[model samples]
Each structure stands twice: as structure tokens, then as C-alpha cells.
Target: MRINADFTQRVAVHFDQTEWVASPAAGVERKMLDRIGDEVARATTIVRFAPGSAFAAHTHDGGEEYLVLDGVFQDETGDFPVGSYVRNPPTSSHTPSASQGATILVKLHQFAPNDRTTVRRSINGADYVPLFKDDHETVEMRSWPSGQVVPIDAHGGAEVFVIDGGFTEQGEEFARWDWLRLPPGTRTELRAGPDGARVWMKSGHLSGMV
Candidate 1:
């Protein structure tokens, strides 16, 4: 049940090269990025929901976090459109579905069991936004201008998901929907392509995760 489960090594996944695997739920599929267990596990994924599809109601014992990449995601809490970011803390319950369909980047069973904070929001028009920061992690949305070189300190580890345009790390290129993970103590720089790039990043959380 493990994908890129090694936290001590670097990993990169290009969206175009990955295949979608169906989940237990009908009409729902996922691209697993990393995993540490089966069924109920510590995992990161890209999920797509077909129109009129839904997942059964369930409680999150270890919390859940996600960002809507397209269409709309629905639940009793509300309907979230593209760019929506949400966190359902430990013990929260919901029945999620998509009316017309949707795609999201999700992380599951990755929070402190006692954590109860909840967050729901959307990405705005700003080029840079500090989404959230806590003792465990710092999440952000960043934009790079054409041909820019941006330095990043991955002292506590880091994960980045490309949302638009492209960038090169070391000598590897990352385009839209691509994902990259760097081990702790790594120092790196992203060199934006001709069209620049935009990304969602989470850092510090991987320090002691494995």
C-alpha cells in the first residue's frame, strides 16, 4: 500500500505520467503520491469525482486536508468551487460529493489526533499568499515571474505541487500538476520557465513524520 513512502529520499511525480486508479467508491479515482498504510492510512493524493458521485459519510479520526483544483465539491457544510482549501480536523464527519464533478489534492490521516482546528477558504488573486502556519507546518501559495530563480530552504523538509506554468529544480522540470518532495536539510532553488510558475507548498510537517 506504499507509494513514495521513503521520507529520507527525494521524489517527483509528473501528472502526465501517472495513471488514475479507482477507489472503493463508485466513480471516484485517485493518483496516489505517497502512502504509509492501507485503506485508513497516511497518504497524499489527487482525486477526481465523476458527476453525481459521492463517498459515504465518515469521520476523520486523524484529520483531512484538501484543495479543490477544479469544478465544485459539495457536502452539508457547503459547496466549494475551484481554488477552495479546506481542513476537517480529527473527529469531523462529512459526506462529500461532486455535482458536476471536481478534482482535488488531498492529504489524509496526517494531523495530530488531538488537533481540532478547522479551516476553509479559497485562493485569491494575489501572487503570494500565506495560507496557514502552525507549529507543525507552513502552507503557502507562491508565484514566480518568468525566468526567476527562487531560493528555498528545506531544513525541515518540503513538498511542492505545481498549479500553473513550470519550473526546473536542479535539472528536472516540473510542470502543471507535477509534485516534488525534498528531504530535510536540503537547500534548493526553483528556476521558472518562460511562462513562470505558480505552486502550493507545505513545509516543516515532514520533519518527524516518518
Candidate 2:
């Protein structure tokens, strides 16, 4: 069960641009971008939980990383409101639910073994540090103004989420909630639209594998 499972190709799946499909969980709905499993897979997705909805507890064999795009997300641990960044590294477990509805950009089964742990960050308190002129790194979350180019650094590509506002690159337009996976060694430049987009971006993990 492989859906865009290969890391050698450039893949982009838009959430707003693509329709969603139902999940095995009663109140949970998912739109899979790239996959490699059963009803659940090694994919990137937009998952929505209906009010008071929840999934049974389970182990994440390959880890889970996600960002709260809208509403409030909760589990036994705590509640993550919009603009939260989370990382549940390899061999972690949880039963996630949302009582007030929620939307998330989630990447599954992607993590370095040494990275095992759980992370919860309030992105609103994060700061953007300059990696280089015209290129910056946000250890947190924030906006990238229109026409601002941030190269993905050709040596190792990147993954991106259009969380708020919209972004365009190489003639591709990504609206809110869109997910993109650019393979290692691919150069990318993002230009925000009139909305002056804010995106959650990550890179350098494609090389991590079982």
C-alpha cells in the first residue's frame, strides 16, 4: 500500500483543491495525500474530527507529526488550539479526539529513531531567525509575505503546508490547508498571494527511514 511513498519524486496534494474521503473512525474524516498502508497509511493528510468525536487509543509505530490548522484539538494529554505544532516521534501512542471540531495537517510514520519523544509548541510565541538573507527559519509559525522567496535548499528538499492564506510556486497555487512534499535536492521558492500566506514548513527528514 504505497501512495506517493517514494521520496524521489516531487509531490503536491492540495487539501482545499482536493475533495476528502471518509475514514474508518466514526467521527473522523481524512483526505490522504500520499500513502503506504491500509485505511491508514504513511501519508500526509488533512483530518477533521467532528464535535465530541474520538478515536480509540493506539500506538504510533512510526510516529506522527501534525499542526492544528483550525479549531481545537485534544487528547488525554491536553488541548492544542489553532497554531499548534506537534511531534510524536517513533513508537509513541495516543487516542486523539476533538470535542469542538478541528482540522490538522498530519504526516505519519516519518521520524528518526533518535528523535523519539513528544513535542507540543505554541507557534504564536515562536520567532523567525534568519538562516541567510532572503532565507529564514521559523522555529515557530508565522507569515511569509507575498513575493518573498525562500529557497528549499537543493541539497535536501522540503515539505510545506499552506495553513493560512495562499501561496504560489512554479505555477502551482496552494490555498489554505494544502500539503506539499518536494523530494530531496529539489529547489523551491514560495511567493505569498494577496492574502500574504503563513505556512508550516519542514525539511531534512526524508532521509530518515526504518
Candidate 3:
């Protein structure tokens, strides 16, 4: 039942190294990440839908976030191709399906209450702004040329997952599905080699724990 289930510790694992398990629904499966409860557990995962498959309607009581990995994802709202980043905040609901099938990175029941930021950005559409700084911290997405300058402010933690790249952070190499977490007030940098880089990152959840 546990693949990469290390909630109380800092850990990392490559995606392909983990096995996928069946869900209650047909044509759907998941590579487990983290879980705290049984059926209603808060978790992160890589979910896949087989061709012409669909899932029943569901409510995101604790919220849901996903990045389309391959093919296309579908719902009553519309279709999402690869590179789509989606956020369905708390209390949001939707029915998801796909015709040609798809794979996605999904995070469930993990969002700040009332955090309403919802978006889908094409990773290639915008340029990566290195040395990006704000009053709170400096933020930057990955780029094609590789090596990146990372900045961290204070009172926060971060998780690193390579969506697509040969990424290395703090000298630790990470291939797809490789995951890592840094404690609060910790800082790290990343780089990608010949293939460029894409990642799924979440932060600002440290505070007094730092």
C-alpha cells in the first residue's frame, strides 16, 4: 500500500521505480505518493486514464491540483493537453474523462483555505526568469539551457518533483518521478542537462516549523 509514503520524513524517489496500483474505477490507475487516510486520504499521485475511459463525477472537498503529463485530459468543462496546470480549489467539483487517454500529476486535499489561484500555463509559452525576487521570496521556473539560480526567503519549506528533465538539486540528481523535500528556511538550487527541465513545486508551508 505504501510506495513513496514518507510523510514525516524528507525523502525522494524516481517515478518509474515505483509501481502503479488499481483504483476502484476501471481503466484508471495511480502511482502512490503520500496518503494520510484511507478512502478519503489526502494524497499526491500520478494518475492515468486508459483510452476512451472516464471517471464518475466527484467533489474536491479538500481541493485538487494537476498537471497534464501526456496525451489529453477531459472533463465536462473541456479538454486539457499536456503541459496544462490546473487548480480546483476547495469545494470545487468536476467529472473527469478522456478519449485518447492521459497521465497527470495530482495533488489532493492540500491547499491553504480560500486560496483561489487557478491557472493552466504552457511551460514553453513563457521565459524562465532567473534571479526572480519578491518581497517574500525569489521564484523561478525551469529553462532549456539548464542550471538555475534558486532563491529562498524564510519560514517556508519546498518539495521538488521532476515532471520532465534530468534535474539535480543541491547536487542530488533526479530523474522523472524523483521527489525531494526541504525543511523550513532551507535553500536549494536545480539544474537540467541536455533535455531541459520541467517540475512540479509547492512551497510556503513552513512558518513556525522552520
Candidate 4:
């Protein structure tokens, strides 16, 4: 139940190389990247929903954040197509389903307990988009041009998920769906690959919990 739970270490994962493990819901499977507990746990994952698949209504006691990677995602709130970024803050509840199948990168039980902000948006075609920012964390989507070098300061840890193309950081290459987590105080530069790169990033949330 503890997968890459160490906050002080740097970790990287190639999304496509991971095994798909079935979730409690039928037709819904997940590739877990990090976890700290059991079924109801603090986790980060890439989930896929087969056509017509659905999950029962559930409340996010510690909040939920996700991005639609492919296909369409649906819930009582509305339908979200690929490139959609959503945040269902603490105490929100919803029954999610995918009528025509979908894939998403999701984070569960990782919000400040008192946070209640809700956000839903599409980042398709966006060169730079700031999704959310609070005292605890900052989330954003950014695109890098080919061969461009961008500096990053992980003041309180940082995570990057490659959406399209590729990039290299400290000699490590990251392609589509690849994920990288840098520990607090790390300062680095990411150089875009030949085709450039678009990525989703989160930072400042890992300040002191470790």
C-alpha cells in the first residue's frame, strides 16, 4: 500500500510501462504511482474507464484532482473531454462514469482538509495555464518549445506529468505520460526534446509533511 511514499526521494515513472490493476469498480483499472494507505488512501494514479463503465457515488473527504488524458469522462456535474483539468475539493461528492471510455491522471486524499475550492477547465491548445493556487500548493500547465531550457525551483517539492512530446531533466528523459517527482529544495532545468513538450505540474504541497 506504500508505493513511492517517501517524500524525501526523487522518483520517475513511465506511464505506459506500468501494469494495470483493477479497481473496486468494474471495468475501471488503475496504474498507481504513489500510495500511502489502503483502499481509501492518499494516492496518485492513472486510471482507465472502459466503455459504459461507472463508479458509485462517493465523497472526497480529502479532495480529488484529475486530468482527462483521452476520451470522455462524465459525472453528475457534466461531461469532460480530453485535456480537462478538474478539482473536486474536500467534501464534494459525485458518481463518475465514462459512456464511451476514458483515461485520467488522478490524485486522491491529498488536499488541505479545510480546502473547498472547485475548478474545471480544458487546457487543450493552451501554452500556459494556471489552474489553481492556494497557500498550500500551485498547479499549472505549461508548454515548452523545441530545445528550450526551462528552470524549475522546487521550493517544497514538485511533480511533472508529461502530456505531449518529451523533455530531459538532469540527463533523465521524460516522454508522453511520463511522471517525475522532485524533492523539496531541488533546483533544476528541463530541456525540451525535438518535438517540444507540454506538461502539467504541481508544487509547494510537499513542504513539511515528510
Candidate 5:
């Protein structure tokens, strides 16, 4: 089953408007943004766990990265509250559960072959840092101030997710939880709304794993 699986093109979706599809685990559901293959696939999703819900122990064969959007997500190692960003490298395993419930943005099977770093931290505590740097690829988080216009030049494609507040792009408004992906060589403009915004931005990584 493939959905927006093409890497050469662009894809965008507002998760707030997407339906929640149930996962194999009870009380857990997902809004898949892009996917390839079947049940075990390369995917990006917004996952929700109901109170007291838990997922069976599993290993990340390709890798897993996620950011908690709400409530608390827990595993054998520790509890991750909202705003927590975690990366479990290839071959890592864990039993994840939610005591009060949680919503998280997750990416699966998207790691580079030699990218084996394991990271876990709160977005609030970490300063903006470059995740990748190359002639065609770059990833970083930056501040978006209210009423400010920011230009974007997507040399090899780009993706953005609003982490707080809201913004407008090409006259379309995007609020918290909204995500956008643009094709290669596309030029775009972003204007922050009255509430301002904070965003996670990734450039390139659209045609190949970075």
C-alpha cells in the first residue's frame, strides 16, 4: 500500500484535516502523511495513543524518529512529554506506552545508511542546530516572528512543520501541526501571523536519504 510514496515529487498535508486510521495496536491510531510498502514500511505519520494505551515491544530495523506533540509518551527507558524529540537508531527496541495519552509526529525508515546517532531531548531545551549540511541538503529550526516575511529557496525540495503558533504561505494559512513539502527548485514565501510561529525546516532530503 503506497500513499504519496513518490520521493521525486512534492507532497503536503494538514494533519488536522486528515482522518485517524486505527493501527494494529488497540487505542492507537495514525494519520499517515507518506508511506511506502505495507504494514512494515517507510513512512511519516502522526500517531496518537489513548490513555493507558501501549504498543508491544518492537525493534526499529531502519530507525525511528519522533517528536511528542501532546500528553506523555513512555517506554522502558523513560517518559517523554510534549515537545520531546527522540531518535532511536537502527536496531533499537522499545515498548512504548502512554499513561495519559499522547500525539507524536513520527518518521520511520528514513535514516541514512551511516547515520547511527541516537538522540533524545526536548525541543525547548535544545538550541537550533544543523541536522545535515551539503550542497543540496540542509535541515534546521528557526524562529518566525509575527508579521515577518521569510523567503524560502528549495534547491532540491523542502519541508516545514509549524511547531508553535501559525504562519501564512502563498496566502494560505497554516497553524500549529501543519506541514508542508515543496518540490525542487521551488521558491516560496512565508509570513507569520499575529501569534508568530516556530518551525522545523528541512531542505533537500526529498530525493535521497540524508
Candidate 6:
């Protein structure tokens, strides 16, 4: 099934307002953001694992990327706590689970054919750095001070995910976990709220997806 599968248009998902759908595994559920194809698909989602829940071992043929939103997520390699960002490149495999429970933001099958770099970081421990950059694509994380107005010119499309606090865009307030995807050539105006905000932003990834 397809949901928000069109890349040519803009999309925004306030996860707090979405309902969770159970996954194939017991005690695991997901709030789908964008999806294409069937069970095996290119997708973005917010996933949750109830205590003692686990998923069978699986290979990421097209790569997988995720950030732990709360609690802890674990696999054969190690445990990832809240704020951990990880990227398992194409062909990687793992069996994921949660002992105490966890919530994560994840993307599947969205890597470029030749992109094979693997990364694991903690948003709280790592200094803000450029995550990815090229003439056509860029990704980064930044902090916005309270009352600051930040304007963005997305020449080849843009996406933003709030990591902390809240921000307003076109008068709509977006708190942690809110995600926004905009089409190419769009300009966005964002203003930080009283507590300020921290966000992960990406641009130019939609250049050809549209």
C-alpha cells in the first residue's frame, strides 16, 4: 500500500496525532509517515516496541537509518539509548528488540545505490556536525534560540524533524517528533518557541524523487 508516496508534493506529519498500527511482530507497532510498495517498501516511520518485544533477524538490502526517540533499542551489536542516531548501510543485517521498551524514528530503503557509509552517534554526545553534503544534497543539525526566526530556501526540497522543544511554521506549532517535508523550490519560515528548539534538517534529497 502507498501512503504519502508522492514525492512531488509537500507533507507534514504530527506524530502525536497519528494512530499506531501493529507490525508483523507482536507488541511492535508503527506510525507510518511515507510509504511506497508493500511490506518490503521504501518508508519513513515512527516505531514503538513494547517491553520484552523483539523483531526477527533481517537484512537491510537497501539500507536503514534511525534515531532512538525514547527508552532503549538493542541489536546484536549493542544497545542504543534515546538520542542515538544510527545508519546501517546496504546489505547490513540485525535482529532488533527492546527490553524496557523504545520509540524510534526510522527510514528504510532510501539509500543511494553506491552509498555505503555506516554511522552511529549520540545527539547529546556528538558535537553538531555536517552529516552529509554534496552539490545536490545536504543534511545537518542545529539549535535555534528562542524567539529567533529562521528562514529556509529549499531549492531541491527540504525536510525537518524536531529533536527538542518546539517551533512554529506558518503559525502552526511543532514540538518534538513533528516532521515536515517540503517540495523543491519552497521557502519555509520558522520561529523558535519559548524553550528554543533543536532540529535535524535535510535538503536536496527530493530533487529527483519528485
TM-score: which candidate is best? 4
Off by over 4 Å in 1: none
Shift in Å, residue 158, candidate 2: 0.7
Q: How accurate is candidate 6 locally (lDDT)?
A: 0.87
The better-scoring model by TM-score among 3 and 4 is: 4
Write one digit per residue (lDDT tens) for candidate 5, span 19-82.
9999999999999888887778999888999999999999988889888899999999899998
Per-candidate local distance difference test: 0.92, 0.74, 0.69, 0.95, 0.82, 0.87
Model 6 vs. true fold: TM: 0.94
Residue pairs clashing, model 5: none
Task: Please say which candidate is ahead in TM-score: 1 or 3.
Answer: 1
Q: Across residues 66-111, which tens digit of lDDT does each residue of candidate 4 receive?
A: 9999999999999999999999999999999999999999999999
My TM-score estimates for the predictions, one after another, are 0.97, 0.86, 0.81, 0.98, 0.89, 0.94
Instruction: Output the better candidate (1/4) by TM-score.
Output: 4
Model 5 vs truth, CA RMSD: 2.4
lDDT of each residue in 168-187, candidate 1, tens digit only: 99999999999999988889
In model 5, the Cα lDDT at residue 51 comes to: 100
lDDT of 6 by residue, 88-179 (tens): 98999999999999999898998876777888877785437567675656767778889999998988998889888889988888898899
Q: Provide the lDDT at 76 for model 6.
A: 94
lDDT of 1 at 195: 92
Q: Indicate the residue-level lDDT of 204 in model 3.
A: 55
Cα error of candidate 6 at position 176, Å: 1.7
What is the C-alpha RMSD, rounded to one decimal, of candidate 1? 0.9
Which candidate would rank higher by TM-score, 1 or 2? 1
Clashes of 5: 0
